[model samples]
Target: MTLKMSGFNIHIVFDLLAASLSLVGTYLAYTWRLRAANAMALGKLSTGYGIALVTGAAVGGYGLGSANLILSEIPMVGRSIVGALAGATLAIEIYKRFRGIVGSTGVIFVIGFTTTVAVGRIGCLLSGLEDQTHGIPTGASWGWDFGDGILRHPVQLYESTAMAVFLVGAVIALAVRSPFFLKNGFYLMVGFYAAQRFIWEFLKPYTSIAGPLNLFHFVCLSLIAYAIYMILRSKDART
Candidate 1:
């Protein structure tokens, strides 16, 4: 048997290819409108893809850190939250000065965030078994087995399914002719995805603090809270 290793990851052989695909996949979704809103406007697709690229890297850095595979050549704080805010603010200022367009909120969060999660999770799968994960064992054929005869749940599949459903719903809202759907569509997407993730996290094994307060689940709770807030705010805005 041959051992493959690159700083703690097994699939380091094709790692770069996976990341390249993620970036390109996000880029294509972003730029699919095929036309700009106006002459001076930056294409919505470009702006959305740009945001997804930045955010994707930020999340990837987290995975790298978890893997303990830090590369010294790369800037330590690059793609971080503070860095993103600073970079985006500066970019927006320059765009404003030069009469270039900024992406809309709907584009940034819905398309960008969903694409980021979809692409970013691939890294998690590549990283494999390191990041938090858990699932039931099935005697049925077709499931991932890892770590010396340990049968594990395919948590990533659960998340990917959630993202796919949300993406389809988002496309429908954006493309179909329906005012009611368009008006609250974004908030609805957030709420549904957040709720699904929150519930699914329970299936994974996690430490409990005072009962059901693990790290992953805790983050899910935050998303749930934000989803609720987004729904309420959207309703108020509509009224």
Candidate 2:
């Protein structure tokens, strides 16, 4: 049941690869005229928006990530993509409200963000137990042992695969000029990511915050609610 891997820490390599691929994908999406309007609009945003996004993402990603580890009594620091998304959303919303900007400004990021996550998780998987992103032990035939002899659910791959599928679908939607995706792609991606993450949390061994739920469960729920509210609000505005 033990899955053997190279001793070298290749997480950094995959991280770089993910970043490179995301950049390339974003550039292609922009140049190919897929969601061109949104891409151009995003490019025209003031520098303040970028500052807010980076600041919020940095703080939230590390803050929530470290807090979760502390709560779980694990002596380590980490980063959470969910936290980054939440922070970025809050920061962007505040910026938009102050500047009177409306509608989803995140459409341009859907593909790149999804690509980053879909590819970055492979780093976590290869990082093995030290990454602390592995899942609880399972007897399933596909379970992988991260040098511990215990067959655990490969939760990282599960998430990666889910996001990859979503990435494909989103790309296709963009290619076809799907109206729903054009307007609500950002919300759809956020909701889908949160929903899938919520399901996968059950397979992780993180300490429970409320009975069966962990810190991530609450974060996921908040994100799902936010996405739903935004989508509904957009619909109401149109009507």
Candidate 3:
């Protein structure tokens, strides 16, 4: 059902909250020695690597998101976190290859990225039908009515909860100094996010591109493959 909270838009509020929380989390992680100083150093925007990430994420987020909406015949702008991740991955890979950089430079962003998705999706849920991220109709007891009387799956919350669970696990892994997370946490997070997004796509009403799969299905699969390839090819894996 629609929330009757007057005045401010809940979606924008949550977006700000997500950003603030992500920044705080990143700062705490660095200050508390949860992430390596060197890795965090690489995240600096002054570096070319950071520029590539921002460029790729912006282009991909808008390009792919808008492409999906157009393909689905929806007359509105869109943005996809999945697209941003994929774009950033491609950009960073190219930069690393040219600069002879190796291993994952994305470990510093794993928690912050996860935190954004986990918290930002609540805004989507509250934005109601205008957000265009609602799930297909469902008969489940927990289904919500987003302005329209039809009970839908509330996939936004489902995704948010899933990422929140992952965030908890990631925090614990960091706290314990898990070697796997220290070396390959970025790949792990990408793979997990793609896997979950792939599943959630089935519950969405987006237009199908291949039989029953939508544009995001292919994107998710590509991300999963990318993550796997990177993890397998990592120097840590060889050692």
Model 2 spans with C-alpha error above 4 angstroms: 1-8
Candidate 1 has what TM-score? 0.57
| Clashing residue pairs found in predicted model 2 | none
- The alpha-carbon deviation from the true structure for residue 232 of candidate 3, after best TM-score superposition, in angstroms, is 1.2
lDDT of residue 124 for candidate 1: 49
Q: After superposition, how far is residue 206 of candidate 1 from its true place, in Å?
A: 2.0
- The candidate scoring highest on lDDT is 2
Per-residue error at 51 for model 1, in Å? 10
The list of candidate 1 runs beyond 4 A from truth reads 1-104, 134-142, 177-186
Q: Write the per-residue lDDT of candidate 2 for residues 1-239, one digit (tens) a residue.
A: 56566624578888899999999988887666554656655754789988988988898898888888989999788898888888888888898899888788888788899999999999888888988899999999999889978999999999999999999999998888887888898999999999999999999999999999999999999999999999999899999
Candidate order by lDDT, decreasing, is 2, 3, 1
Q: How well does model 3 score by local distance difference test?
A: 0.86
The whole-model lDDT of each prediction reads 0.48, 0.88, 0.86
In terms of TM-score, the best-performing candidate is 2
TM-score of each: 0.57, 0.95, 0.93
Residues 1-239, model 1: lDDT tens digits: 11122423533433455456546644554455312322133233355446654554456445433332223233333222212322343344344445543322333245555555555554444445543343556454545564435566566666766787787777665555345444444456555665676676566554444476444444445545655665576667757
